[model samples]
Target chain A: MTLLAQYALTGVVTGCFLILATIGFSLTRQVEGFLNIAHAEMLGVSAFITWGLNAVAGWPFLPSAAVAVVATAFLGLAIGRVVYDPMRRLGPAVLLITSVGVAYVMAGVMHAIIGTGIRSLDMPLATSYKAFGLRITDYQMVVVALAAATGISLALFLNRTKTGLAIRAMSSNPELAASRGIDVRQTSRATWLIASGLAGLAGVMLALIATLSTDIAFNQILQILAVAILAGLGSLYSVIAAGLIVGIAMDMSVYWIPAGYRPLIAFLVVILALLVRPQGLSGKARS
Target chain B: MNLVQLFLAVVMFGSLFSVLTLSLNLQYARGGMINFGTVAYFAAGAYAYAIVTQEPPSGLDQYLVGLHGPWWAGFLAAGVASMAFAVLTGWPTLRLRGEYLALTTFAFAEMLHSLLVNERRIGNGTVGLANVERPDPGSLGLPDAWAYAGAAFLLMLATALVFRRLLASPYGRAIDAVRDDETAAEAIGKDIARLRFEVFVISAVPIGFAGALYAMITTLVSPDLFTAEVTFFVWIALVLGGERTILGAVLGTMALVGFQELVRAFPFESVRAAEIAAAGEDIVTGILFILILRWQPFEAMVKRRAAA
Candidate 1:
């Protein structure tokens, strides 16, 4: 029972981080209709930016995170404008290749700037809290709460706000949305900003839990891709659920299998997911 | 530099890349499968050859089992193993369309990398296998470089001929039909899945063969050789050379690989050119890919060919 509880705790913690990282990808895919391979790199960018501010500039945690989020949001907006806008006119294959290229460029630039060395975030370790005989770190709790809050806010933004509705309209049918005077371009830019900012927040939270490395972005991006696909592309709720499942499964496998075999488990899960639910959990049936 | 030596070197490089590009083009151009795990088969071939010919380590020779197969046997075994793996994975994953399939294969490739890097017992982990013997060219009396280049050229010509025949055959037309529209092909009595699986296996054989040759050429096999970057580079070559054109893949690989070597040789003081050279290959390839896709280079080439 205790072992199960331990696994569950670890799973939830890992799931929380996955959700944070993947929610933005889910949103952006919904808005843009293509997988943004550079999403994980943007997360890395935010984490590094936050680290620099906190470690070098001596800023407090909240202030640094805020600055990183803003910076990432702007960067996301710029990417949407400069890279994606022109490519949107091309076919899906072209866009897919371009996003991959953009991802390579972003990863290269990040590595070049950050010097390719792993860096530890200097945030004070959060105290552990016990709930129902299960130990939970304060950071983990904060991450979960923040993720939930962000998710709820996003739901409200999509369903309630005029601009969010416009974004949804655009995602559903860009041509029709444009005909309805929805300003598809503006909505896309806004979606990029919000989605990438969320990714940044996830990155900061993730870096807090683990050491930051150049390859972290690529690894996390792969995981996020899996999560986004399992969730069926655009369904935000399904993405969260899928993220939780993958995280828990990954954490639980460590107990039963050798550490080296951990990656194979994720690969197995992804392959199985592709075989069983190619369209993902909530994806629309292809015509 | 000796003109003969330089010419031989370029030919060797060109032939090796031609092999890589042919396999890539088979999937990307002919079958419309965006395989990001192309290097997995290549790595598998290299490792297979390495394992078959490897002697036990000095300290553990008594405890661990070792194989001492002929080099030709090892190479053939590598190709066969790679083909088997491709068939196994391609059966299920080929059903997926577009990016999902790409992402899944990419994940599989990464898994292969991790498995190779961590499994010290089976393969030597990250240190990789070394001191494998190269194929002998005894009694040919030609220079060693010329001999190797000659053999590689023959292999490249053989591969090109085989692929051209395959592409022109009825089965090749089936592969193209499946790529164009799976449902339509299915309606027309073609088993889309079966054809895809066939092409997947066929394409993997040459890739694996090339990989085995690569291990022999370099006289080593390491986890680093099977990176996503290598697969990406192959993708770039296939795209730049005009997919579906056998000769184009050969030309494309030569140009891209030559450009990569040139970039590495250039004096760039600002960016750790080695590191950027490592990363820049993908960046340049990606840029070229986007450019070629946008401009439709193949269409223009075809027009010129028609005019000629």
Candidate 2:
């Protein structure tokens, strides 16, 4: 029973990281009207930036993570302004395919720079805390706390801010949002920054909790897609439920099946969810 | 590498992968479905071919099944296996539209890949199945490389001709009608879902055959070789060729393959240099993909010719 609880605790941490990773991707789908395939590479970008600043440049962890997040936000903004802005009129399919190109470029650049190897930060090793035979690491706790913080902050931002409302309006209907005094360009740009920044934050969590590799970001996309799809693509609040569901399902399955199937479990749960509820946990579907 | 060898390599791989690009064309252009899980079918075919022709498991072999059949029988099984897998995956997911469909298919493919990697009984786990059997071209008094290249070319030609013929027929018109406008097509008595499911299944057969040919050329089957990368590569080719034309699709595959071959042929001084070159290849391919998509020169060319 304790083992199961431990697994569930770990699953919650995994779920938190997944939420951080997927919120940006879901946001991009909502506002930009396309699935940005390159979005996960932004995680790779931020993770590596943090690694480079902390390990290679001998900086402390918090400052390195902060700089990495900010830099990643700006990088995403530039990519949006340069590559995606002109192609906004080309329809979602074209933009989706083009983002694959962007991913290839980003991944290639990382491979050239980092080469191939598993890397870790220069920070202290994770301190494990135990209660009632359940164990959790400091980094894992940070991930959970940060996920809650980001989730609450994002919810507040979306509901309470002027720009946030504009983003929401633009996502639901672009032409109407534009005609109703929303700055289409600014909203789009803001989505990119926030989405990419979120990805950066997730990348930091990933680095803290796991090893880093150039190809690690690619692997995250599968789970992120699973959560996003299970959340019904555009809905934000439902991502919380969907992420925890997928994460717990994947981790808990290890008790019964081999650990190698963890990733497979996430997809299985998603495929089953999709089959039963095509619009996902949310009752709305993206048209 | 020698220029002639490079050309043969390109022709060989280009034709083999063109089979994938052609099927993707049919699915995306005519069927209006974005199948992001194409590698699954290809992997299915390859694994089927490998298992069927492989000798029954002996010492050190962990896989559960090996039919010990002839190459021809295995090749046929490959097609059947691919189509079967497609039916299984497509039946449930086809009702979902657009990116949803894409994601489902992709999820299914990843699931398959994970299974293959984890289940040693499937293909000896990550070690995969090696020493796959193939018919000998030397027995027919032909060079092995040239024979496989010719076979790939013939397969590609057959796929292209059949698709062209299909698209020219009334059935093709119905498929197009569905893509152009679903409601109007349904209003005119077309079974939209059935058409899409059929197209999805039909296009899968050629990919399976291509996968068998790919296994024969390489004489190996592994989870690593069949990844999402192959799916992306085919999509890039489909986009590069302007989506709807057979000739354009073939040309795009050939050009892309030729470019990759050239990059690989260049000599490098060190592992780092080779790594950088490979990365450079990716960057250049990505840049080309972006440029082609941004300008859409191929689409423009087709339009100009139509106007003329």
Candidate 3:
């Protein structure tokens, strides 16, 4: 019983991080109507920036994280303007391929800059508190709290703020929203900035938990996609729920299954979801 | 330089890519399905041939039991395997459009790659298979290069002929109808799912067959050969030549491959320079796709051909 509790606790901790990562993917898809395949690259750039500030410039954690988020957000907006805007002017297929190209370019640049080495941050691991004979880390608890706070704030912003409402309206019908005097382009830029900032925060949290590497960002991106798809593209709540479920499933699978087979489970689940309810759990059915 | 050797190499490389582009064109041009999983079939065929022809001559292999067959049998087996996979994947995924279908297929290809990399019990893992015997030319008493080139050209001719016939057939008309308007095709009594599955299988077969031939020529089969880069290269060929046109696919592949070889032969200052220049081929191809898509070069081609 204690062993199971420990596993569940660990699962919830990792799930919190995944929920943060997936929010950007979910929000971007809702606003842009296209999956940002280069999103993982954005996370990677942020992590690298964090590493640079902490290691090279000898900056402290909070300040470095702030700088990293701002830099990554700007980078994401630039990528949106340069690559995605031109791609949007073209057909959907062209845009999709362009996104793939951007992903490739970003991966290549990251590899070139970082030299494919794995690095770790020097942050202290959060202390653990025993509960019902199970150990739960303070860092884990903080992660959960942070994720919940972000989710609540985002929900409120969407419902209360004019800009957030404009984003939702643009997501539903861009043309109609533009006709109603919403600055569609400005909303898209804001979505890109906020989505990328969230991704940067997720990257910092992920780095603290695991060894930072270039490929880590892409793996997180794939996990984010799985969550967004499982939740149905536009449902923020479902996306968070799906991320938690998948994160727990992945962590639990490591206990019973060989590590080699864990990726197979995710692939199988995504393929099955695609075959059955491609619109996802909360998605509206398209004719 | 002997014109024959250069010509044979060109034809051989051209035929391989032509097979790739043709399969891609079938799905993209005829069915309007953006299949990024073409390499899945190609890898299936190559690995099928490698396993069937060159499995370690020991123990009863359960997962791929009868895989150690002759070259012809291996080719046929690859086609059958790829077609089976296509039928299974395409039936459900064909319902998606544009980016969704592309991402789904791309994910499937990545999964297939992961399986190949991880599943050593059947596939020999990343180390792959090697030293498989090539088809004999000595029995026919011809020069090896000429014989291999001739065989490849013959395969290309046969594929081209079949593709031409299919495009001109009633089945081809149905494929185009589905591509143009899936809802309209369903309204007119066309079974959209069945047609999609059929075209997908047909397209996959050639890709698998080409993979078998590639394995035979290279005398090696590894997972690296079937990466998304390869699929993207085929896309470049299809877009450059003109999607949905068989001749365009053939011409585009030949032009692109020939250009790459020419660039490689140039005396760059360093090997890094050469490698960078080679990577530039992709950049150029991508730019060309954008330009051609915007300009619709095929329309001009149609006008020019009509004038002629």
> Which candidate number maximizes lDDT?
2
Q: Give the per-residue lDDT digits (tens) of candidate 2, residues B1-308.
A: 89889989999999999999999999999999999999999999999999999988889999999998999998899999999999999999999998889999999999999999999998899999999999999999999999999999999999999999999999999999999999999999999999999999999999999999999999989999999999999999888888899998999999999999999999999999999999988988898899899989988998999999
How would you encode candidate 2's per-residue C-alpha lDDT over A1-287 as one tens digit per residue?
88999899889999999999999999999999899989899999999999999999999999999999999999999999999889988888889889999999999999999999899999999899999999998889999999999999999999999989998998888889999999998899999999999999998888888899999989999999999999997699999999999999989988999999999999999999999999988878556
Candidate 3 structure lDDT? 0.77
* Best model number under DockQ: 2
Q: Candidate 3, which segments miss by more than 4 Å at Cα?
A: A1-8, A122-143, B1-14, B57-67, B138-154, B240-242, B251-308
Q: How would you encode candidate 3's per-residue C-alpha lDDT over A17-51 as one tens digit per residue? A: 88898899778877877777778778788888888
Error in Å for residue B90 of model 2 = 0.9
Please give, for residues B1-308, the per-residue lDDT of candidate 3 as tens digits.
35565677778878887898988888888888889878898888888877788755455332343255788888888788788878877877887877668767877887888788777765666766667656788889988777777777777778888888998999899999988888899999999988887888888988888888888888877777777778877887777787667888899888877776666556789755655565565455555655665566876887799899
Of candidates 3 and 2, the better by TM-score: 2
Two-chain DockQ for each candidate model: 0.47, 0.84, 0.26
| Candidate number with the higher lDDT (1 or 2) | 2
RMSD of each: 2.9, 0.8, 3.8
Over 4 Å off, model 1: A1-4, A130-133, A179-181, B1-14, B56-65, B142-146, B266-273, B276-286, B294-308
Q: After aligning candidate 2 to the native by TM-score, how far in Å is the CA of B145 from where it should be? A: 0.3
- In terms of docking quality, how is candidate 1 classified? acceptable
Q: What is the DockQ ranking, best to worst?
A: 2, 1, 3
Measured on C-alpha atoms, candidate 2 has an lDDT of 0.93
Candidate 2 lDDT for residue A56: 98
In CAPRI terms, where does candidate 3 land? acceptable
Residue B298 CA displacement from its true place in model 2, Å: 0.9
Q: Candidate 2 has which clashing residue pairs, if any?
A: none
